[model samples]
Target chain A: MELNIYHLYPEHLNLYGDLGNVNCLKRRCLERGIEVNVVNFTDDEKPDLNDGDIFFIGGGSDRAQQLVYKDFLQYKDVLKELIEEGRAVLAVCGGYQLLGTSFIDKQGNNIPGLSILDYESKYTGDKRIIGNIIIETTLNLEPNKLVGFENHGARTYSKYQPLGNVLVGRGNNDDDMKEGIVYKNYIGTYLHGPVLPKNPHLADHLILQALRNKYGDVESLEPLDDEIENKAYEKFIKLYGK
Target chain B: MVNVRSMIALYAGKFSKQVLKLINSSGTALPGKLALRIDNNFLDNIEEKCDTVIMVTGTNGKTTTNNLLNHVIGTRTDKILSNLKGANMIQGIATTYVNNTKDHYDYGIFEVDEGTLRSVTRYVKPDYILVSNFFRDQLDRFGEIDNLVEDVYTTIEKLPESTLILNVDDPLVNKFTQLPNKIIKFGLDLDLDEVQNSSLSMKNCPLCEGKLQYSSHVYGHFGNYECDKCGFKRPNPDFVVSNLEEKASSQMITIDYGDEELVFEYPYTGIYNAYNVLGVFTVCKQLGLSDDEIVSAMGDFSFHLGRMEEMEYKGKIIKVILTKNPIGLTQVINMISNDERSKTVVHILNDNPADGEDISWIWDAYTICEREETVLHYYCSGIRAEDIALKKKYDNVPLDKIKINDNFKEIIDTAIEDDVEIVYVLPTYTAVFETRDYIENVVKSN
Candidate 1:
């Protein structure tokens, strides 16, 4: 079995280890005897969204996000199709905000987004949501309290199902008692603990969904021992909270 | 009186320093903060009097470069004021000034934080402003790197008299051209060895949003690069490393300073430290230090600002290299991978305030995989041991070769007990101190 992973706008959005999610996903797949091919879609090149079994994007700085904003639009229609077909998409902070309809900046400017989901982010221009974040995710990734770090300035609001409830740090808009937007096979959030290695379940979920997209129906991926991942999560929750 | 507030602040700061010292605290930033509160002109008053005030600002190597300059210059004259312990904000700079106000120093060397450059320059006028290289660092505290470069541009815009020393090899630093003031640029020559990849590429040009192409790619997004859309390119460095040869525990480098060449055996390894030495050398040369003086000073300098340290624990040689960011971590990983010695590499990570709360950079760094032929074992310790454990495990490190132990003592011991020739412990800022203390305690007990 093989998986094709497309990294979107890595040149621009490679801020804060967002590529780790792809590495983790690829590693898990390889461990289970699954071959993996990673194709990075950077500046100027057109991404073959059809070849994508699992699509990943990390967060970028503001200028960097704007740099790739136009290029990102090319993925909207194809990404929606892929999501509908049960393909997995894991978008982080700025990547998470990009999937929304629009973002309101400090001057109340409504910057347009990809509109892959019905959500919007607003810059508070106050204290940034920066800290260790633990969320009770309903994705049923066992030890369901997902651990990661949040260092974003904007708060996102989505009417669709949330990825998780905020057990500790601020998630989404900080007041929603929620974190991230979850729809179909797409999971977008402000979790930058690269939101994969420590939270092994999410990494596997993306892999499993990618496998399903390839084979139509799949039972599950062969489980590898997640002792390190779980222990890291446990240590995070113990040192921090929730 | 205009001078009354300054005088009171000076006396009060001195009294507070004494009180803190008596109370058994070296109080690096607090005394400065109090002085700034009492008189905002505290740093200005000191800067106005100093003949040569050098501001060293950058994401990394600020402490190392500042200390290197201080060490070389101090050999000539004891009339020097410096923040040697790395208190580098406006408050920290203020503290240094308040403490050293009584002395009519010839040189006031300071390690100014990159983010606080504008804040520091607004009050004080530096004779020479040295900028090393900029990287994405402490994002939770400083926001982002683009903003930092912009802030630096604005900071340098108004300072007409301050001579700007820059690292032109870094494409980001190339944006500072067209400035009115004198600029001295330094970088590694294209002839030296280059790294395979950047910490991660900025892809687009820092000047224009155009595509950036590198003729020679060094570690991180540093090297001889040019922009396609705009005609922006890496400036020819005034002081370039013409030759760089790695010795056993040091680097033999020959720096070309346009008119003369300064050849010296740098007591440190890595191109990162080479850049630091080059920056220091540029500043020293601009200060009229002869090539021989610089060579002598650099050859004799020993600065262990907790960057990289070496010790023997339980008869096993152990080396600790501070691993904070992706580029720094990648450098260490590459160093260990190239090492022929049988070694146990330990990664100690912490999520404290000192260490960026976001531990995502760990994933962004190079992985130690498929090179386990030399390294015997891997131990993950510190508060975030499990995080790095996940990193190694996914890096294709066999489970038996990887050990996850949060206890620093036990992990360090386990690593030392491995039949390897060396034990390499790479720790974050907070972890480095704790790990060092543990090692020192072991030596003391023996």
Candidate 2:
């Protein structure tokens, strides 16, 4: 099986090892004997959003996010169609905010977003939600706790259902016990432990979704022994809470 | 009255230092922290006490470059003060000043932390300031690289008479040359053996937000870059590493100052250290150090501590290197990968207050390390051992080969027992001390 992943604005939006998500996915696939091809779409290149089996957009600074927003607007309809088709997608931190309706900065000005996810993020106050985050997530159909780190000023509020319930660390916003937006095969979150490698179940889930979406049938996938991965997850869960 | 407040602060610093020594502690930062609390004007009084003050600040290379300046300058004169202990915050500078106030110093060299440079500079107005380069570091402490430069700019704006030494290869730092202060630029001007590509941290031009295109991509968003849209490019540097040749354990290079050229062998490997040397050479040349003096000093110089410090551990050769951010870690990984030794690598990670709480940078560093075929066994240790292990595992290191040991002693023992002839140990800021102590006291003694 071949997996084609399109990294959106990787040059601009790759911050704090956010590209590690892309590396984790590619390496995991290769280790599983799945051929992987990654194509990076930066400021000038226009990648066919349809050609990609999986799509990834990592976090960046506000300036970088704004620059990417203008470029992303050109493919707004294509991205919406891709989401509607239930294509596997992952967005993190600033990229997660860009999937929303808007992101409010410190100056209280709204930089409009893609509006793909039913959420809006605002600066609201000065305090940034930063720490190791663990959440009870069922993206794999089995109850599991996902671990990661979140550092963002924009507090998001979503009308749609969240990806998981917060066990520890501030998620989405301070008031809500919810974190991330999970719609169809699309996932957006503030969890930037790059959010994949630390949580092997989530990485495999995304991979399974991408494969199922591509070939239309995937038997219960052979599970790679995740002893170390699980150990890492449990370590974070024990350290952070829950 | 012998300035009773200053006297008290000095005595407090001295007493704390003695107590820390009695307790067998390095006490790098706490003594200064206490002295500053006792007297706010402690650093100010010391600044008045010194004849010349040279301040260095940046995310990385501050300690290495500060050591270089102190070594060269102190060789000529005994009356010099420097923060050799890597205590670089406001209180730390205050502590250094309070301790050194009694001695009549010709120059006070300090490695000022990026976050506290502005506040620290308010009192100790340095006659010369050297900014090595800026990278996204200690994100939990300092927000962004863009904001960091502006903070340093505010400090530079205040020091109108100070000569600002800069690294023009870094576009982010190159922007500071536009400051009204006297600018003395230094950069690498050699044909890079490999393409120098910068990290995602520096994609857009600092001036116009236009994309920066590199003619010769050197390393980590550093190299000869030009913003075609804004016409902003790397300015011509005065002190340039005209040619650089990387050797097994050192760098052989020719440096050019105006019309004069001096060939020197820098006793350090990696372009990262080359940049540090260039910063030192710039200040040394400005101080009128001749070619003979520079060559002699650099030949005799070695890294202060855990910067690629090698030792025999349990009858096997082991090297310990201090790596902080993704950029610096990438360079260290490259240095290790280039070496043809059988590599049994041990990574020590800590998320203590000193090490950034966000451990995302490990993911990037591991990505680079994964590219190397030299690594045979990998051990992850320290507080964030699991995080580091997960990174290595996902990077395609076989699960069985990757070991996560929170115990440093066990990890060191395993590394030593492994059949590999040499083991490369990579550690973060806080982990460096613990790993060094373990190797020094445990592994070596055994």
Candidate 3:
């Protein structure tokens, strides 16, 4: 099987080891006898939605987000169509913010988002809610935990349902127990320890979703021995999770 | 005239230093903290005493560059005060000044943290502000690189008289030249391929937000860059490394400063260190130091702990490389990959406030996964050892090759069990100190 992943605004919006998400998706797919091709669309380059199976967007600095925001408007319609078609997408941190209706900057100016998802984020304070985060998630009728790091100043409010409930750390906002959003096949989260490598299950889940989108019935993946991965995940949960 | 509160602060700081030493504490920041608490105007008073103050800051190489400045400038005169003790924040810088204000030093060379540059420079008007380079570092604590640049820019705006020595190769650092100040730019003129690796942070122009066209990447974001959109380009360096040839353990370079070109052999291993040499050379030339004097001072300088310093443990050679960010870690990995010896790699990752609790950067240092053939085994140890281990695992190092443990001794023991001749220990800020101490007392105990 072949999966084409579009990495949006990689040059500007790629911050905090965000490219690792692309690496995780590629390596995991390659390991499972799937050819994964990653195409980087930066600045004003529009992504071909038909060619894309999984769309990954990572976090960035505030300035980077502004730069990406300008170019984001040009491709919002295509992105909306991709979301409506139930194309598998994972947007993290700044990418998560950009998937929403609007994001307010430090100066309280609202930067328009794709609005494909019912969410809005605002830079409420100078303080950022940062630390190790553990979220209890139920995607595909399987209850599991996702562990990663959150480093963002904006507090997001979602009208649509979130990806998970907060298990250990601050989620979308300090007031809410909910974490990321799961609109159709789209997933948006503040988890950016690149969010995928540490949570192989999630990486596999996204891959499974992409495969299912393409071929309809997707069976369980040939389980690679996740002894070390489990060890790392278990350790993080034990250390940082409640 | 010095106020009574300033006098109290001075005496209290002096007394605290004495008491701290009696308790065997390094007291890098305690005295300064106490002194500042006594009188908020303590640093301002100390600044009045020092004739010339130089502030050095950036994401990496602050310590090395500051020490180089201290060596080059201090050897020329005895009346010099420097924070050679690795206390870089406001408290630590204040401690250096509070303790030495009475001595009335002619020069003060203090390394300021990028986040603390604005706060520190508010009082001490430096004669020279030397920025080494900037990268995505300590993201949790320092927030973002743009925020750090804003802080340093604000500080520079207040001090237009201060001579700004910047690394022009860094687009972020080069942007500071836009400010009206007496600026001297220092950069590596060698081929970008010679020094640059796969890891890069700033790929877009800060001004135009356009994709940066790199003629060469010296290391990190330091390179000859041009943005066709905004026409923002790399400035011609005032003091430049016209040529660089890497030897076994040193670098031979011809430094061009306008009409005067001096070819010298620099005793540094990494290409990043070559940039450090160029920065120091620029500072020395700006200070009116003779070429012979500057070369002699730099040549006599040696490694200052935990930065590519090697140690012997039993029959194995353990090279301790301090890696805090992706840029620094990538350089160390590149240097180690050049070695053909069968070696065990130990990576210590701590999420302590000092090491920037956000462990996402480990993934960006993808080069760690590049030289898999040379590495025999990977011993991942620290508070966040599992994170590093997971990163390595995903990078395709087989699960069997990685041993995740918090204990340094056991990790080292396992690495040497297979008669590994070399063990490369790459550690973060706090982990490096702990590893150094562990090697001193346990691993290499006579």
Candidate 4:
């Protein structure tokens, strides 16, 4: 089956390797005999979301996030409808902030978010999180742990319960708070570009879920070589594993 | 009797060496106590005492150009102070002055940071300024290339008609040659190899809003070009590098000034180093160095500590190339990625704030084509190890062909395990030092 992926704010939210998210998904799906159609939407250009199966928004600077906020406001209603309709969606970093209620920049400027994820982001004085980060998560639907990369300055606080618990790295807030929002068919986090590349299992989890939801109880494909996967796993365990 | 401050300041040379060693050992940030104890504002007190001061500033090639100028002057009896330890900021400059001053130096050959160039130049009062080029770097701190250019120009405006040595090859630096100063320009003659592969000349012309057309690009935005509407052209350089030839082993660069031509057999491999050699030759000839001394010194020079520094690690030859930007990484990839023979590569990426918290730049670097079949085994390390491995995998490098080692020690061991002919390491700035420390310890233990 053909899949359409909408990448929002390619220019602004591309501060980190966020483009790698689109590339990773496209590559993985193509390898599994799937045809993925990717469309990059930026500035005032509207994307044709009628056939979109998944939507992605990556991260950028505060200035860039504000610019994207101005551009994304035009399609706020459409984006909300898509999320409500169970179209798979992922928002990371500035994109995650824009998916929330509001974001306060370092200079105290407030920008409105889409409020898709019931969370708010506030700029904290602490800027650096220099090392590796590991997320301890068990999706109710999936058996494997969710692993990805995290690099951000904005601390997101939610009055409501977080998407999940933080196992390794600093999450949404300074304290033990949910790092991102994961609701029915929607995933939003501060993890910046190439989140899927570093965590192939996470990418597989998302794609497999989307596929299973559409195709129903599809048999699993043979995993990649164990030797290589084990080496990668050992590396992750040493840095962020318990 | 000398005061306590003077006593400590006099021995600042010894203290600076010890501090560098401490930084190497601990892998810690710049020590606060050392910075506090050393009087970095010593330049303010002696600005009126010096007759001439020259500040060379740019992202890359500043150190080489500064060292060349220092070597060419050959006024050994004269006192000279410079950022010899790769310290290019205000504190670094202050530390250099504090360490080198027994008396007023005849010339202060310093390399200043691009963002701090304006303030540092104002305080240092440079008689001569050598600006190499302006490229996109450290977006969080520098914002854009134009901001850095403005900073350098503003600082140059304040200087007293002293000489401005610039690279005409770079459009940004070439713009300064038009300014009111005793300006000298240096550039490379566009050859077939230089012009054929110009991918990075897409930026708008600084002179006109019109698109830029290049006869050829050396690398990044450095190339020979002419504006379509404004009639601004790449001028005949005061110093030109010609006869560029690269063999399997080493590269040769020939620099031609008005009356003399010096052929330098460069120890390093890439055209970028040739530009650096050209910058050095321009400064040397301008400062009155004989062709013989220039040629002699060129052969004797060694790559600085973290640059393309080579070392024997685990009975294998390893070449460590420091990559901070796309252009730099592209050069590293170009130099090694073409060889069909199987080779091992250790790619490291860090998330340290100093490393620009955004690790997304790695995607741009990894997109450069690698000879996948010849790349026997790839190792990715650093805080962003998995991210790098994922990038390589996305680039169609087989999943089984690459290894991700989070622990740097494990990565090094894996890289050095086989009897590899050449191991290519590309690392970010933080990773470069960390990798260097790791290699040093491994070598010492063996």
Q: Give lDDT tens digits, candidate 1, residues B149-254.
A: 8888888998999999998888777677668889999998754444454336566788677888878866787888889998789888998998888765788888
lDDT of 2 by residue, B264-368 (tens): 786688788889888898998888887788778888886647877778865677888888888888788777766776679888888887899998887665344
Among residues 3 or more apart in sequence or in different chains, the pairs in candidate 2 whose N, CA or C atoms overlap within 3 Å are: B196-B217, B196-B218, B196-B219, B197-B220, B198-B220, B198-B221
| Cα shift from native, residue B257, model 1 (Å) | 2.2
Which parts of model 2 are misplaced by more than 4 Å?
A106-108, A138-140, A217-219, B193-201, B313-316, B366-376, B398-401, B417-421, B443-446
Interface RMSD of 4: 5.2
Indicate the worst ten consecutive residues by lDDT in candidate 3 chain B. B192-201
For each candidate in turn, the TM-score is 0.94, 0.95, 0.95, 0.75
**For each candidate, how many residue pairs have backbone atoms clashing (under 3 Å)?**
1, 6, 1, 5
RMSD in Å for model 1: 2.4
- Flag regions of model 3 displaced more than 4 Å: A44-47, A140-143, B194-201, B369-373, B413-421
Q: Is model 1 an incorrect, acceptable, medium or high docking prediction?
A: medium
lDDT, candidate 3, B1-446, per-residue tens: 85999889878988999998999877688989989999887889657777888888888888888888888887788788889866898899878866774457778888899988888877888999899888888888877778788778887999999999999988989999999999999988876574443337477788876778888767677778898689899989998898888775678889987798889886777888887888888888888899999888888787656776777777777778889988888888777776777788889888888888888888778545455676778889888887888888766677778888987767866765657778888889887776777776655555
Scored by DockQ, the top model is 1
- In terms of lDDT, model 4 sits at 0.68
Q: Among all windows of ten consecutive residues in candidate 2 chain B, which has the lowest summed lDDT?
A: B192-201
Q: Which docking category, incorrect, acceptable, medium or high, applies to candidate 2?
A: medium
User: What lDDT score goes with residue B160 in model 2?
Assistant: 95
The candidates' DockQ values read 0.73, 0.62, 0.68, 0.20
Ranking by DockQ: 1, 3, 2, 4
Interface RMSD of each: 1.5, 1.6, 1.8, 5.2
